[model samples]
Target: MMAMVTMVAFALEGYVNFVGMTLIERSANDKESAAASWCDYERKGTRDKVKDLRRMTGAEIDWNKRPYATIKELNELRNMFAHPKPQKPKVREWEAVGTDAEFRKQLRDYRPEYEERLTWEFCTRAYDDVEAIWQHLLEVAKINPFDALSGGSQGFELLAWVDENGRETRA
Candidate 1:
């Protein structure tokens, strides 16, 4: 569950950065890479991306405002689950057992109280918070997320108006 939330959060961060790059390129009329190559080279993280987004879009994306606020707590929990230090031996054990409880001993390591804390309701709430932030971003970017013709259970043709020599015309 922690892994799922972490993955979603990271993906959202990447998407936000990509949108920032797109806005910057479009506004400047520079047909360069849509994503920030400089930031990537420098290994800039999500906070840097958020700053870039704010600068490029001129929108105050107060992550502490609404749905995004939960992200900080979510990240903290994710880190705790991922890299539980020796100082918190119980947390480490919980993480290890939850990750893979193949053995009876591993299963026994997890207490009933821990199970109560890490319930289905808790997991879903965390996921919903991440999803809410994603939805908010989509709205801010004015991106229409759905295209019936593009994505579904059934696959569609890859071609986009093929010409005489099998050349593709997008517009």
Candidate 2:
């Protein structure tokens, strides 16, 4: 039943995972080559604080896990939408439809909890749940203010420290 929730959540936001992957690759680089990376050379003018965060808090992240998790979720969602859809015999008015006087009588069997959970309310809750997963993503990636579509203006703030020689220190 709960698995159904995860499936729907991913189905709804599968595009975000795609966008995030592209953004991460475009923004991130290997630690050794990071001096020339966008986050360093170009972005420093904007997110200069990230440099300090690295030096003081050692906030460097792996960056690989988040994309992997998002891709996995997208796969699960595609399966759910592409799989053979169960028949939900439509009901009519006037006299009625299906069997019982009630039109929706055919759907009484809720053995498969997933079918029961197919509601707007459930989808909304599922969205919140999936978003929660990414909360941890930002923390794990050590990337502050993880707004990918924000054009790099917003994300976790980086710390900066100027040593006695007035040189930037790497944390």
Candidate 3:
């Protein structure tokens, strides 16, 4: 579950960067300037990058809405696991009654929220949110998601060659 959540977060970041870079490359007049702009854009944090991509593509995303909120929460979980810090143990109190006596107990340990987020439900939801965001961005950018994923719209061709006779052949 943790691995899935982490991968989904990474996938979202990668998708945003890929789309932003493609847009920049297409719109810029100079390749060098486009490369430099991409470098500056890539330095931004994940949330900021998402916002920048949304603005660039003219897509509206409500941060407080379903898929967006879920993705944000997933990113938070990923960040927590990625950059962990020592957390003070939480104190939990419990009461017990035996046949002979009643006892009170205190336990100190990590909070349940961390474990709670590692559930299958959360992981599945994170995956769904990533798909939703990916589709939304692709739609707004007017790029077919299937083509993008299959490398069909990447603006370059492979298996093409020019013979010594200067005749070009394409696969």
Candidate 4:
């Protein structure tokens, strides 16, 4: 579950960087300037990077809404897992149970709030949030989501044609 959450977060980060760089290349006057601009952009926080992309592409994403809000939570969850600190578990008082012949004492260890966040539902939701954000950006950029490298199950394919003259061209 931790792995899924972390991967989803990292994938979202990579996707934003990819989209941001593409936008920079398209808008900048020169390759050198684009490269330098990208260097500065890469240093910004994840939220800032997303905001930059939204501004560049005219995407009106409400930061307080579903998928967007999920992004913030996902980042926090990723950070918690990435830089985990040792924590003392809350141990409950021992309780006696059963008859004297089978008597046993049990103690419960309380889980931390961060640990509680690692649920299967959360992992699935995080994955869905990433897909939603990716699709939204792709729509604003006027790029076909189906042609995207991460586009679902259709996979990716390249085709080329060769004429009788032996010259090859991509279809």
TM-score of each: 0.52, 0.34, 0.75, 0.74
Residue 105 of candidate 1: its Cα lDDT? 74
After superposition of all CA atoms, the RMSD between model 1 and the true structure is 10.2
**Residue-wise C-alpha lDDT for candidate 1, range 1-89, written one tens digit per residue:** 55666675676566665565555555553445434554452365555665666665566566766556665655555565666755433
Residue ranges of candidate 2 with Cα displaced over 4 Å: 1-78, 85-114, 151-171
Model 3's TM-score against the true structure:
0.75
Model 3 C-alpha lDDT versus the unseen true structure: 0.80
Which candidate comes out best when scored by lDDT? 4
Q: How much is the lDDT of residue 66 in candidate 2?
A: 44
**Which should have the higher TM-score, number 2 or number 3?**
3
Clashes by residue pair, model 3? none
The whole-model lDDT of each prediction reads: 0.58, 0.45, 0.80, 0.83
lDDT of 3 at 3: 81
| C-alpha RMSD between model 3 and the true structure | 8.4
Candidates 1 and 3 compared: the better one by TM-score is: 3
CA lDDT for candidate 1: 0.58
Global lDDT of model 4: 0.83
Which of 2 and 4 is ahead in lDDT?
4
Per-residue CA lDDT of candidate 3, range 1-171, in tens?
A: 778889999999988887888788988999899999999999987889888888887888999986888866887889889998777655655554563323322222334667866889888888888889888888887776655665346565576788899788754
Q: How far out, in Å, is residue 6 in model 3?
A: 0.6
Question: What ranking emerges by TM-score with the best candidate at the front?
Answer: 3, 4, 1, 2
